[model samples]
Target: MDNQYYCNRCDREFQNFNAIKSHYSDSHKKTLHYACSTCYQCFETEAALATHRRNNPGAAPHQREPKAT
Candidate 1:
């Protein structure tokens, strides 16, 4: 069986865990900018933002992709 590693911080796909960890540590060791407009809350992934929006009736979270710097 093969495992696939997906990085939400950098929006990257990796085949190995070690490589993804190194890439994440080097490239995305910063704040994620996927903020919620209603409460100005930040989240690490879009799925988290979506879950937040779903939980909050009036959230209306922004659908922006955060670029790693």
Candidate 2:
């Protein structure tokens, strides 16, 4: 359908950007907002960024881990 949006990465179709973005973030582990300040890189989630920081300590300021409430 012309109104449907197609995801090239996953070959999935969505009704809108929000749906596609959500699908991409979950299925592809891609970031919609969170980013690395030093390299201007983005991650799918905070945990992914944390992993990156652990692997690359010299890259940028580390993002604080979420505190358990």
Candidate 3:
């Protein structure tokens, strides 16, 4: 059996050892690309946009609230 590690941050699974290593170097290890210029906020992906929104509540418009009757 082959042994491999998983990355929860990127939500990716790897098979080859080299692939896993490179994925970490390119995605998980670095925060160079995942940055927001407007607020100087760092994020891993677009999904992280929501997290930034939470942190800087006054910086941007509030997230759409759930509708109520």
Candidate 4:
């Protein structure tokens, strides 16, 4: 039977569906055109990097906010 999984982009063979999915996502999902300057993490687009920065913000080094009363 045709139970095997393969990468749609590269045609690489895989037996498990999740493995192939991850492989595709990591290897082929994005073009990797953008990267974060602070963390040097890669992203597929500028919007993604902007979103990451907005979410993380890198507020402060070794600093914390006061606990709510």
Candidate 5:
């Protein structure tokens, strides 16, 4: 049997050896697109932003969550 590894962060799937390797380098290894100015925390997607907001009550609600992975 073969195994598969998926990136929850990027929501990408890999079936074979090379695809998984490329996915990690191309998606996971890159810097986050969204950043928290107050804490300088970086988030790869908007969903992460919402998760952070839940912990930060003072945060604005207008912030958007990244597309589902």
Candidate 6:
């Protein structure tokens, strides 16, 4: 297929790069990100939560940080 993104870990095909990246990061890597304390918002990736914090400067960090594997 043209312009397809396939996961190296699971060999799954995706139409876009973000889908493949998210799939690998979430399913394979299992890199969990803590959600915001105040609003309690969780995201699939750290960058997503970082963007949220950047947009909302008042957002407080989660009490429990993600453990390193």
Task: Give the TM-score (vs. native) of candidate 3.
Answer: 0.32
Candidate 5 per-residue lDDT over residues 35-68, each given as its tens digit: 4433334455677756876788786444332322
Cα-based lDDT for every prediction: 0.59, 0.56, 0.47, 0.50, 0.50, 0.57
User: What C-alpha lDDT, on a 0 to 100 scale, does residue 53 get in candidate 1?
Assistant: 82
Better of 2 and 3 by TM-score: 2
Q: Which prediction has more favorable lDDT, 1 or 3?
A: 1
Q: In model 2, how many backbone clashes occur?
A: 1
**Model 4 alpha-carbon miss at residue 23, Å:** 10
Q: Give the TM-score of candidate 6.
A: 0.41
Q: Tell me the tens digit of each residue's lDDT in model 3 across 1-69.
A: 243334446656555434544675677664322333334333445567667676676765533322212
lDDT of 1 by residue, 1-69 (tens): 244556655567666545565566678774453555555445566778788788898755365644445
Instruction: Estimate candidate 6's alpha-carbon lDDT, on a 0 to 1 scale.
Output: 0.57
TM-score each candidate.
0.45, 0.43, 0.32, 0.43, 0.40, 0.41
Which pairs of residues have clashing backbones in candidate 2?
A: 30-44
Candidate 4 TM-score to native: 0.43
Reference-based TM-score, model 5: 0.40
Summing lDDT over every window of 10 consecutive residues in candidate 2, give the lowest-scoring window: 60-69
Q: How accurate locally is residue 30 in candidate 5, as Cα lDDT from 0 to 100?
A: 48
RMSD in Å for candidate 3, one decimal?
A: 14.4
lDDT of 4 by residue, 1-69 (tens): 244654435767665444554565688863444434444444445676578678887733221112212
Give lDDT for model 4.
0.50
lDDT tens digits, residues 5-47, model 2?
4554666777654565677678887634444444433445677
The whole-model C-alpha lDDT of candidate 5 against the native structure comes to 0.50
Q: Cα RMSDs of all predictions?
A: 10.5, 9.5, 14.4, 15.3, 12.0, 10.8
Top candidate, metric TM-score: 1
